[model samples]
Target: MRVVAIVLLGVHLAYAGTHSLKYFYTGVSRGIDFPEFTAVGLVDEGQFMYFDSNTMKAVPKTEWIRQNEGEDYWDREKQKLIGSHQAFKYNIQIAMERFNQSKGVHTVQMMYGCEWDDQTGETNGFRQYGYDGEDFLSLDLREMRWISPVPQGIITVLKWSYNRAELEGRKHYLNTVCIEWLKKYVEYGKSSLKKTVSPQVSLLQKDPSSPVTCHATGFYPSGVTIIWMKNGQEHHEDVDLGELLPNEDGTFQKSSTIRVTPEEWKKNKFSCVVEHQDKTVTEKEIRKNNASDDSSSQRSIFWQWIWHLKLDITVG
Candidate 1:
């Protein structure tokens, strides 16, 4: 999958007890075929709503959200995003000017979100901006101030920080309004968001000299841990963990590879242990690539595993 640099705050909390509501906004310079501006909303790491410059309307991506929300809700969201679209376009131009860039592809992105721990009743929120894949500015909620990482963003920080009332309002929305909506969305889609599905674990090896790959697929909630064990002891060396990727069915998949020579492999017991929710999958044997397996079929299946990771947005 071709992953973008847009960071998602609190998305890793897509676990059993923690829930997150996040938004991502992107603005691009001219010459790109992609949308000039786009927005997306996610709940528990599943996309629920989306809007783009071409569409100019906020549309629900999930059936539950579409069924529960009325026309007025959609209309209100559309109007708000339309305004944001214009603002982002202007912001992108301003950013380009600040960086003294005349042309080429440039992107400005914003990510903000709230996380709630149901078991502990704890809540947290964050807002950050990026320019050309680098951090530009962010909100310091505790101090109620804006912080800029790049020199180009210092002007924006100084100007935005002076607005005390707006800062207070932003803080209130993130801490209060965002949490309320997240709870409502969770209730609306509890059947999907709260459900847990165990993964189908497999141990694959292309050749005798290749590293052993432990693959887990079709897992829900995406909070999974994969580790290598040697002689029943936790092993950390020569392990490479892959990113969690979404499946076509809305579930997730991940892989962890361990490098060990054939001689060492036979000398000790090596195992791959995967833990998701309450289920555990332990595999001690390797499944070698079948001689009859077609490479083209494998390539097709690999492309089928790739999917776009959508961005998200929420009205404060």
Candidate 2:
């Protein structure tokens, strides 16, 4: 939606947060990224801001505020605000507070009045208290600087929807939040990499010297493909890319195996190429003779076993 920009004209007197004053100017300014919707400005009400590295300098918060809201300018002297080189999370909190104070918009209250979606809630897409497409989100303020794409990969906006109650209840919203794309992004790289099948298949074995079967697996949102090879050349016949199995953390895993008895296993180079995006990863395990019948399935499924991970935080 195209947002009609509203120029803020600070509620106070002539010396407001909307323009750069002539007599004052703060050293550093804190503002939001218009493109990404992330705020990154200092907020010293008095315009007297300092930093361990840059010392305290005179800068007006009004002008900084005016930078985005209106045509207000900052004065070089007099007006002052303290240093605002604080953490972004804390800064965002300040932004939210200021927004609520200025506009009489209380997010917590909005959230309270809106329907609950804690069961499968995700801090994704745009808006803080609302859902985007599928209309799971109550609001779709894609026009705001701080509510759209957001910034720094952190959801700075407190999501809320103006018409969240209209998205219907759990039955439909759940499916809305249960986005199909979430199951499409897999955590690849080395941490999630499984090294069960390594190197080339030195040998092959099958009970009746026929075709062999194998499975492919990965974290959720992953795509799997079956790739059969003979003497390092890709073999395309009789391979099936089965329905992907889901991971606990929302990834998809899949496997496909063809029954290859002893004779076929010995002559064929077998592998299941895991596919995600434009990358293709290969894992190999070959048998020299068609008589080796100990299923490789056991080792393949080892990573499926889970252990817990925990972390503790303290707030003083």
Candidate 3:
């Protein structure tokens, strides 16, 4: 993820909470063939109902898409979307070839999101695209600068897309086509969406000499914080924070690790505190007694164990 300022129509914008608009194309592409695209839209971190050419349905259907008569219907717009999807489906291969690797699953994601003041609707933020899960290009919209390097041809096309005339045209389309879709998405879908699903937390010490790792999985709306705690206080030293990644089920997972000496591990109880969007907190503890080390054996062996913790928040 990259952070940048947002500027539109020669006006400067202030930074605020992240608001994102993303179009993602993901599929496997082998050899010279165009990759099959599974395109979807995301706002903030939640899925918004969008046309999937493969499914021909508003995919990953939320309650709003499922209920609300004719609200999720977008058959007439599918043809227009397909053209954009195909451009990326073919262009992802071009990007791979340019990098000299063209075999495997390819993903192209275009994102327009920024931290902008809601009252003023101003932002100093970024417009970016990634290829195969890696950053390929980025534009600092506020500074009118290309934040990442791109080939000459690609940059030329990007410049044209950002040109004033094209931008005005896009703004019109967005007001009519995008904003309306977003209004429906937020009004009907967003509030009802799950903010946090209790994480499946695990403690693993695979090797006797390696660090103890606490892994969390099956969470939603990925702004999760995983921290190691010594006793009841936060422990930050020697701790490594891992990247939050998506799961096959469209949920999220992450992990954190901390190095502990054998004596320290035996003497102190270590805990992992997970904080999520819902204000529901969970703590998973790894104690010397709970750790799967066979006391009968001369050699110490630590086994992996999983603990599920849940906390419910009640709003008064």
> Which candidate has the top score in TM-score?
1
**TM-score ranking of the models:** 1, 3, 2
lDDT of 3 by residue, 1-316 (tens): 4211110011011112434444443433544343354444555544444554455444434555456536335554466567756666567666667667746654555555333333565434434555554555655444444444445236534565457675555444444455454444455554454444667776766566678877777776667888788877889999988655444354666778899886887788778878776554455555332434423111111111100101000000
Q: Candidate 2: which stretches are off by over 4 Å?
A: 1-211, 286-316
A best-first ranking of the candidates according to their lDDT comes to 1, 3, 2
Candidate 2 least-lDDT 10 residues = 307-316
lDDT per residue as tens, model 2, 214-254? 44443322333556666777776666544433232223345
lDDT of 2: 0.29
Instruction: Tell me how far the alpha carbon of residue 147 in candidate 2 is from the true structure, in angstroms, after superposition.
Output: 44
Lowest summed lDDT window (length 10), candidate 3? 306-315
lDDT value, residue 194 of candidate 1: 50
Q: Model 1 segments beyond 4 Å from truth?
A: 1-16, 203-213, 230-232, 238-240, 257-270, 284-316
Instruction: Give candidate 1's error at residue 70 in angstroms.
Output: 1.0
- The clash count of every prediction, one per candidate, is 7, 72, 6
Per-residue C-alpha lDDT of model 1 across residues 78-147, encoded as one tens digit per residue = 9988998888878877877888988898777778889999889999998887777667788999998888
